[model samples]
Target: MNVFYEEDGGFKVGAVLADNTTSLQVEAPHGKRSKIKAGTVLLKFEKPALSEFMEQAQHVADELDADFLWECSNQDEFGFADLGLEYFGHAPSTVEAAGLLIKLHGSPMHFYKKGKGHYKAAPEESLKAALASVERKRLQALQQAEYTAQLTGFSCPEALLPQINMLLYRPDKNTIEYKALEQACHDTGLTPPKLLEKCGAIPSSHDYHFNAFLFEHFPKGIEFGEIGEFDIPQDLPESNVSAFSIDDATTTEIDDAFSLIHLPNGNWQVGIHIAAPALGFGPGSRLDEIALERLSTVYMPGNKITMLPDALVNAYTLEATKSCPALSMYLEIESADYSVVSSVTRIERVKIAANLRHDTLEPLFNEDTLARGGPDYPFKKELGILWELANRLEIGRGKQGSNIGTDYSFVVKDDRIAITDRKRGNPIDKVVSELMIYVNSRWAKMLSEKGVAGVFRSQFNGKVRLSTTPGKHIGLGVDQYAWASSPLRRSMDLLNQRQLIALVRGEPAPYASNSEVLLGAVSDFELASEAYNSFQRNMERYWCLRYVLQEGINEASATVLKENLIRLDTLPLVTRVPSMPELPPGTQVQVALSNVELLDLAFGCEFKHRIELQ
Candidate 1:
């Protein structure tokens, strides 16, 4: 047979190449004696390279349903040259035809239907089946559109498109659809109960799936912008506390909120307002079960899927008002050393008069206006007291051998996230943070000492490997430390909270809770943290790439930190010293960000190439 040897020296047989090149023809030994023309049939690669290899290759081509020619030889050195072969009534140059053959041959030849070529795999019948399925789906959707149009008396295809899309795209899940159905019924004044009854009693459907369904019914009326703004109804029956916020952007259901009270006892009474998620998302619902599966809320940059719904989270369960039940941890400590001379942990109700963030209050500190307002006097006074307490406590902890983790802060400027090394730490922020840490640490220790079954949240002391005895908590600068602060985080904290609650209530601890489960939970937490770090690092790389292309200089002082990672001083704000590489310590380099595929060894992340200068 005429064979065309590829660059890799693989043979392809055809009378007239797919590219209509006669010079690139593959003809059989028998066909060489006969006058072979364009469109001549030949055997494909069928046999393995070891036995009748050409025939095996022909068999593969036959499997792809390719029309192969026999013994049609090419004149080119690579046996890929095309002869004068007519293709679709147009005869192109032999070289051009050969080039085209090479192009088709080199491309994913396996993508074509089987019996075509060895590279051209898979059965043609399977492809036809896949196409038929798509066609059937399209036809079914068209029929549904027609039916829907008739019922609604809508003639426009634009109007019908949404309905058809939803019928075909809506998920099989029921609960999500139930929620959407309820929303649609409320919005369109349709009978939701009757409609739900007509459909099998499905409990939940995914939000996107249900939304797609609604889009089908009222494509024009459905506002896409409003779909993302998932606000729960506030008119629902009030519980002990209600969700109140001026804007949707700032409102998030978090475990804790802090309010400051200037107490006569000298130390400020800082109220930690945490949403009781366990109360609403307890035992039964599929959501609760899923929450148990995941354990905590993980905030990835591009996405945030909350553990609890806004209803329980932002509303009923969170500590919003003075009457909301809370467990107050009051510490009467010296503001100079952050030493807790006296402390009281009480289970009671509290009011968070102000829910503030560092960003929100930081500007106010600059203006000195918050302290001027009489209503904000208490907040200001408490903030002052808290800051003093926090600094002293922070110092005291350091003295006690606690490793304070590195703080990497950043800000969103002009839609791009920029890393900032600004010393933005405020006394007020520190005060609240330190107070919480102190209380959380104390509770963790209390539970651990009491031999209670609870989860421990501690960082390993720079040790790479997992071992029986993990060294000091380096970040905390402590010989050992754990957390029991944020119960709303995951069941780990919840378990710890329950233990602390039992201790406070003078009840015996439930020792039946498995240690294995706690360890498993710890392992999960580590995995989740790693995932978060990976996501953040990826975004950082993207931003750094953009910076290099737009603002960064071509020649930046770089130090090869690791084998592949080279740390470049891109911004003047960065205070950390350069990392040492195996090569000459601080080797200057003219580096550009080149897209490099992340290897399995390097983790599934793209690397920023650093070209070192000699």
Candidate 2:
């Protein structure tokens, strides 16, 4: 082997004949470009050392004297023993053969003089084992990644997200219908809270149940109410409103009713009919006790568990079909100001006609169809008088700023919730409500004037104190007042009815001195019942979220009427909607959704991701 000539400095410097393969021209990067030079200190053939095979073989080639031919087959291992051919400028055939042999051996090798060298493992076997170990580690890591992805219920139900979007429904007001909620306990191996937490990530029935549980368990305070059942027709006049089947034995208990009449003085008279339930339920009866315990009805779409039983609310003591037991109070309304001008109390039997619900009656008064519909339609001649009277009362009430807030209604169909905001006041319903308010207000005033103890119906005024309005009939735009109606459904009404009985009989009123204490209890019960209903509504929403909003695009607008939360108008058409924050007020955004879990109910088919701004 001969030293190569070089023109680029270092090593053998000088050109060699063209036939000398050890010398050659090469180009190298000098700042931004490359320059060519001859005799670039090229090498002939040189063997890579043991250390070089383990790390940088190219570095060893650079320091060699011969032209180092870097040849590698498909196999990764090469050995020094592969350098068997003598180099004489060009040796393609022999060099290629040696390279093939090294690849076949499949191992790195180190060679030393037999008598003076050290001992080492066979390069092929050692290197093969090392590579296999590396591969095994890589495979284990990949398997772990897959396993981690599949685990779903530790903190989130990623695994269940795909199934929740299609199984939920809303059956009634503020209620969710997930037929699978009970079954989830078995397979999920979790308590209600745990299940809710995991399913919160997707759509699941547990979402609603658990969210309600959370709020109920941690309420700021608690309130309680006593239950009562009253006759609707006996205490009020009939509006001739053929709404629901008032004669049906299954549901036609007279709890409330109303009538409007024209007085000789050219003023209108509004009458409210009420059944006295407190007369029978008493204070310690089984139904009374249960009513006290339950405090309110738990109304779901398919099922309803009343706070009182049919024995008390429907059958016994109910003023139905011209039958009445004992009456408490009669309220008279003066058309001049739509005011309760006079009220009288006595024990009297009242007549009954028909019972009605808003749903059945709304159709007859529908904005679309009227008297032209058919024969069975109840919107007849005399009924028009009642409607006219109701309209007058409502108009007068509105001008006075009565707190008759706008309301929304829903009809559940096809396991979905259909919402409607077009429920303008039903004449019959309004007449009934207004007449009852008049009667109750009269009774409340009578009790206050008589210095007797009785229950009062009250609502907190939207003021800084959040306290029940101090004697203001704000909802009716009247002076300080309270309500005492539907004794069977409300303990306060029962107490008032009982007090009215004593007062009418000229008997001394009960607790005339400490009436304030009794008033406190009544207020507490009313407030507690209201809180309970509010809680139930929130719980139902949680269920809807899990079942409808977890996996779809949700387009909605919301308003914050109260300080607590914003109400979104998204349920009727969209299911599995995304959260509202991403699509802030007045600004809309496209989203990809998977599931929604708010307050406990799971909803939606998929989670949503924002796609574009609108």
Q: Who wins the TM-score comparison? A: 2
CA deviation > 4 Å runs, candidate 1: 1-251, 262-273, 281-288, 316-323, 335-338, 364-378, 399-421, 424-429, 459-461, 464-474, 508-516, 543-565, 568-614
What local distance difference test score does each model get? Answer: 0.44, 0.44
In candidate 2, stretches whose alpha carbon ends up further than 4 angstroms from where it belongs are 1-254, 260-270, 284-287, 298-300, 316-322, 326-346, 366-376, 379-383, 394-406, 410-429, 457-470, 511-520, 523-527, 542-566, 570-594, 602-614
Task: Count clashing residue pairs per candidate.
Answer: 69, 68
Q: Tens digit of lDDT per residue, candidate 2, span 398-491?
A: 6332434445443445545544454334455555565566566666676677776665444447421212223555556544445455565555
After the best TM-score superposition of candidate 1, give how far the Cα of residue 471 lies from its true spot, in angstroms: 9.1
Question: What is the per-residue lDDT of model 1 for residues 508-569, given as tens digits with 9 covering 90 to 100?
Answer: 75433465545665676667656545545554444444444445334455554545445555
- Prediction 1 TM-score vs. true: 0.49
Cα lDDT, model 1, residue 54: 44
